[model samples]
Target: MLGTHRHLRGLVGGVAVVAAVAAGAAAHASAAPAPAANGAAAPAATTQKVLFDDTKAETAGNADWIISTSIPDPTKQNASPSKETDWTGALSAWGVALQKTGDYTLDTLGSGNTITYGTGGALDLKNFNTFVLDEPNNQLSAAEKTAVMQFVQNGGGLFLISDHKGSDRDNDGWDSPQVIQDLMSNNGVDNNDPFGVSDDDLDISSGTPTAINDSSDPVLNGSFGKVTSSEIDSGTTWTLHPSDNANAKGLLYTSGSSGNTGVFFATSTYGSGRVAFWGDSSPVDDGTGESGNTLYNGWNTDSNAALALNATAWLGGGSSGGGTGGTTAGSTTGTTSGTTSGTTSGTTSGTTGGTGGCTSGQLLTNPGFESGTSGWTATSGIINTATKEPAHTGSYKAWLDGYGKATTDTASQSVSIPSGCTTANASFWLHVDTAETSTSTAYDTLKVQVLNSSGTVLGTLATFSNLSHNTGYAQHTYSLAAYAGQTVTLKFTGVEDAQDQTSFVVDDTAVNVS
Candidate 1:
């Protein structure tokens, strides 16, 4: 029952090869030239290729890499099946992201590609700068192993990702493949058990699941912040061999807990190539219940996607030319596709003050909102208060304003947003003094508008009535789709009659895009 996944069938190997070559050519023709090197034409960059030995073809688009999997047929050794469809879907999504960032060209292994044992089935390493090994249960043949080693030694990148355990050999027992063992040894990794620290085993279970921060490494810098720990169902366990090789660096490690176990290892400079080995493949899986949510999924944001992209970029000689000579995969070019769009996910909150504020509970540092400061303003002839007005019983304070006027002389404050927040949204809370009565006959209103960096009104997101006379706080929400991805401002345009002056307070301001 081992290696029992379904395989792809009716795969016209020759036709697939033709289609792949044509696609690559078309993409290449459209691509801009690689950045120049020392005023001369740069060396031709290597292609980003991926090998899929699993069952799903739909997931082929996930990587900027070309897809090459065994044809479909249960009886065939590398046939496509539904069981591996989930992994395929995940990889496909990743590929799409990678392609958009100018990292690599994605393709599939045509049916014509030989599925031989060992290096025989090993693709011509010359064509690819990196290979993503995602075999579900099938082990690499001896020839495949030799080809992989040669490919690595000759400056290729190999990202070997193992599932919860190695492969489910009989739907009951799990077994590690020799290909994985060889990979570990080649990269100076030890494959010993959970408790061993010697060169025999790279036991990840010995480490703890902890967060990493403040590093210059491209993989971490682009993450924007720290990586959160999630539950791993079948993560592999490993410990690196004690070596002084300057090229070797540990990218991520686990803080082994009862629920979260295993270490994530990354190595560079294997032969002339780079390799990243992981104990868990779930982070990048695209199957059902695996698309979103960092708790269960592999990569959760653009930062997460950068990890794989950086590896490919480095292996492809895409690193900056001064030393390596190519752009990081994060800079790859292509449009993004899939269910989620924009900034992925965001939380909401509120705040009030003369200066425009962010939505409550939202991080306000990105668009340049001063930390711990209200992002709002009040109009002239108005009693504006910038003191500690508690939103709830909490100790945090918010800005308050009493008595407003319609004249241009009224006091006013606003929150200025940095460029790139054009397509954002804002939410916050407002409280009006219910007892205040204005004798003036003019209409009073509370307004929120999205404006360009030059103060041009792009669109109105929200406007509230009777807010100047409210007894307590009310939550308000608005979307900035009209001004997304641009440098814009969130304005609280309030108007009051000349004779009527009322007090208002605001709290918890959040700005974000889902």
Candidate 2:
């Protein structure tokens, strides 16, 4: 929104709210501890991975909708940033707020990359819990539209931001509204009013849209605090269609209107995913960004920051995808909530073996990586002391597929179970991070399987992603009694898509027979 429309409409107007609060301002510049979620701390290993889109001309003209100039990883800008100014971007305040909470991992889809999905691009939509496209200036390609839709359909959170019509800064014959419209109508996925909100052909000069009265809604009464209103500094509105999607509801409305006709902000769910739409990009404008550009701080005014952050939390953790909002550790999440921060627990059942008393001792060589790759055939560099990923126990562990590229890593060992043994259990401590999420697509995965002495598949035990959402290393136990009495190979295979690293670390393994 680089135009003079904001100036033409006067900037002195106040937005209505129940109270005077600035989650954005506090989140923007505060060095204090971040506001606690539900008055409790979040799990260390579980982080909401968010990807901000910058490849869609988000910075065209005065629009600097980026977390930081640093691509992919924002920490590189300032190893330990305490303020938004520490990072160079208009949305740094938002990024800094999430960082301080220690509950999120932020990334940016830099200019050189294209929006993609199954192609395995490290920045693929499948890898992130939430994707923010603020006031995009360019149109979406066929592939880009499909990638976005599939990302949502497969349980990803999508945040769509738009500006008033005729505000095409890129002069690409398409603005955010038109581009977003095309994405919903011509995607590779379903095209049946996907998000259930149609962009009205109107450029609202200004409006202070107030939030709806819904005490049960987490987006309004979230940990960030109660949200009362959102500003429309020269923005647009949307027409909601609950008929297409029952969950499609307007959250904020234009002045003097309460129905879905004058929706300033709206949210909905399609398939197994969740989505949010904002008519104007002004609320996110922190009024701070790169040099030589005029910006505004709409982010700090009214309840804009709370609205945005809470909505982000809702989108991210409100769904069963990679989101981190509205969810706590050890809690079971529904399709509407985020993934569980606690590690999943349960025994993966395999071929059944007889139950009996201990007859044979634990069988396996180099049970841990402390002895390196000895007695274990593995890919080069699979066993290392590098600290990029922490081991479950000792200084050594079997690290696999952290290359953030198309690759596979494996580690395996053979052992013979005594025929006298009637029961067996194979257990291991595994840690995972990155690309593996609870999405519709298994972009990254760790497969645990059993193979006969001849290298033929005996049975598949279990699979893990992103380390099973554990605090760090969670123990995984599987029943290997089915294979007792026969020589078998226990193998771990980690597969990653095109980009972004998904490290599956294995340490301290054992197979016991009774």
Candidate 3:
């Protein structure tokens, strides 16, 4: 599809609508933005890692809340299970579903293992996008709790599953509720109830989950399906502390309860990561597991299956259980989420990635230039590592056109705005230095534009000249909503005169979508 181009109104606040033709340079201007890498070359791709905890005696008793019987990689039992019975675990359906997606790599923190961060362990908390603790019977050590809290504070997802109070499967004196509460109130990180979601002590024999009127929530209405009412099947409930964590909110509630009390499930954020709380593990139990173990197939009784899968996907990252996963463009992306309040997910400034039809997050890869040109296509020598023109943040910056002759330099990256997103914004910090002393004439110029896949200019977001130079870096942001749902290239081109030299140093770039 052809792209719609917008003209830059001025230095800022430009929002003009216009049509763009198959673009080429003017009679004496630079050529069109170059095509991306030849062959199958694309942005670097990445997979979200999820580590399910079994070390804390998850299988100590009749509670078989495990993705698969096989430790670590679940595929050891079956490469892919068409049905829940294909694997010998109560939560096999959950593991198999994520495995089939191919966008996630699931691992089990088996018995006797310890949760850690920055230790470089293959299964360290830092290595995973999401950490799952389903009905853990053993209380976390002080260090272990610190690791989990620090992980969430530094851009990681946390999934907390709880059981009824005093229901200690391992008879270890601790239960899921106490353990989870301990992690929240007694950790090295912010200890004042970080996520603002606590497991209620009440053991609900059976009840129905009443969905809040939130349709945009990826967990309630996500890829797995819509969550209307879920089965309790011997579960507990959660009480939210919205005052402690302002982002905390209830998604599903118990019958007749409202506000912050009697919350069946809650979600919140801490620092740069996300937190999700579920009252019980029964909804995740697939029922078919090791024989002789009494299990309930609550996974599909109501909206339990959808809630479990969607919550997992949401906790894993991106726009919940939706957004593009494997990409032709090598994946230069990460996942982030918001609660039902849409504090993180539903903002005017969209993020980079999206799944299926839904999309959000920061889109540009190697956005800070700290990774050199790994995800960008730039003219040779454009990605600068030298310190002549300081980067906005890190050591590297994209330098275009410092030659004291008639020359042109360009750099760009291609990104896809999923069809589901309604907003997209491109932003970057630029430092312009020039030897030219023109008070009125615009001798050297740099243009930031959005381009079609075929190298056609879709929109001219901004233009900077020698007159626009400043002592420090200036941030420029443009609305790219017109190019939403399209694979468009963000291009920056600089042109210079034969006498004066002007350099366009750019760093910390991003294309956020929603």
Candidate 4:
């Protein structure tokens, strides 16, 4: 699903004929219009061709689509990294398969023969109906930006994948930030600044949840599941705030964190071209193992791959199947593919709720906070202590402060497992909200460890550091064993710079097994 054009050379027999007949009928109906004075009908509008840039020679006549990535900045190793090869490989397989069912092509463009934004390079966007900005990290040059804007404004289709944190590697520091700020601003999007986690270290373990907004849109109208690969060692989930522009429509949002934050997929009019923006690149990375990895499976099965195909088809003015289409007032098309529908019969169902309250086990909370009537409490004397609240709330809530605190706070709670239970799984949702704290410097030492009944440390479940704690939550799940019937103490030792007032939070504490 990564390459530009996938060539399918073969002859169609009966299926092609049937499809042609259906297409002809639909085309004829859609072509209806008025006749001229001379009694001759006006020529049908030309179908917009989706042009893939061939400057890189990765795509030429073989491509009906193309993929592009940001040029790596040599000075910065931590800047956005390019996954051109991986994207190309994935897209190529998808393009080849799609060609069997439809008339289309795919291609690729890279640094050497890259299509300059305004140079009118290999891609004559006017001839194309859609373009994809796959994993672009560097800021587009002024001219390139203008060209893309023009293309999208001219009724082309566009799909954009913004990078996750650290995707861009520029030593200069200014390169990646400047580039993203410029691109988003030009697109009429106000960067999201939720709860102040924007500047914190990136959260790498968060699950990839689809945005709740615009689930009905064709591009996202299906029950697409998540997949993970082994290549990606770790990464964090992200939230995307909506733009203020009226024409833009928010399509998706991540779940379990602060509302109005998380990943956002949106559609906006860029003149004649329709543009789709995916807030994060984690779902489409070459390396798997991370959440949302299913997006990179074989082109034939991956939902993300199907979305790419639908984008190209819509951009080319092809028949709308998966629901996406041009914005003509009253158009009711949904996405053409990637939806899941079915039902099971005669199957037993289980209760859809959290495990029962702790009944026979011991409850142990962490230091730096005190137990309150409903939950743990933070003292008023601590700076920003008001942010700390009770930790454990039923099975759905954690037993610790979900956000980090500058000063040490105590977290305590009670738990009781069934008397006969021999084994249990202790897990909870941990939101590393250190980014929301008002600290100018980065803090790296945040620790969550478990202790046995003898006060000896049993294990450490999570650790995060060297991240910009601007404001975003990181979810952590830990496993505990050998202490099923005994109560154990859990502790949070904040090792961040005291001068910076760095701390962390833990919530949604639970112990269960089924």
Assess each prediction's global lDDT (C-alpha) against the native: 0.37, 0.67, 0.66, 0.35
Cα deviation of 331 in candidate 2 (Å)?
Answer: 16
Please give, for residues 141-198, the per-residue lDDT of candidate 1 as tens digits.
Answer: 4444544554443334566665444344334232343346544443221111101111
- Order of candidate numbers by lDDT, starting with the best: 2, 3, 1, 4
Per residue, candidate 4 scores C-alpha lDDT tens digits across 1-514 of 1111111121111112112212332332321112223222222233323334323222222111233232221112212223333333324333333334324333344445443322333443333345566544455654455445444432335665444455444332332223444654542211222111121124344344443433234444321222221111123333332222223444444444444354344454422235565544444433322232233432333355544544444344322211123332111111111111231112123233334433333233321122222433322222122323212222122222222333444443334334344335454333333332322122434444556556565444333332222122322333343345556665555454433233344443444433
lDDT, model 1: 0.37
Among all windows of 10 consecutive residues in model 3, the one with the lowest summed lDDT is 16-25
The sequence of per-residue lDDT tens digits that candidate 2 reaches over residues 235-339 is 889998654443567889999877769999888765335688999988888877899765778888889888888877766653333333332211112221111
Off by over 4 Å in 3: 1-46, 318-514
How big is the positional error of residue 18 in model 3, measured in Å on the Cα after superposition?
39
Runs with alpha carbons beyond 4 Å of true place in candidate 2: 1-45, 318-514
- Between candidates 2 and 4, the one scoring higher on TM-score is 2
Structural similarity to truth (TM-score) of each candidate = 0.40, 0.56, 0.57, 0.38
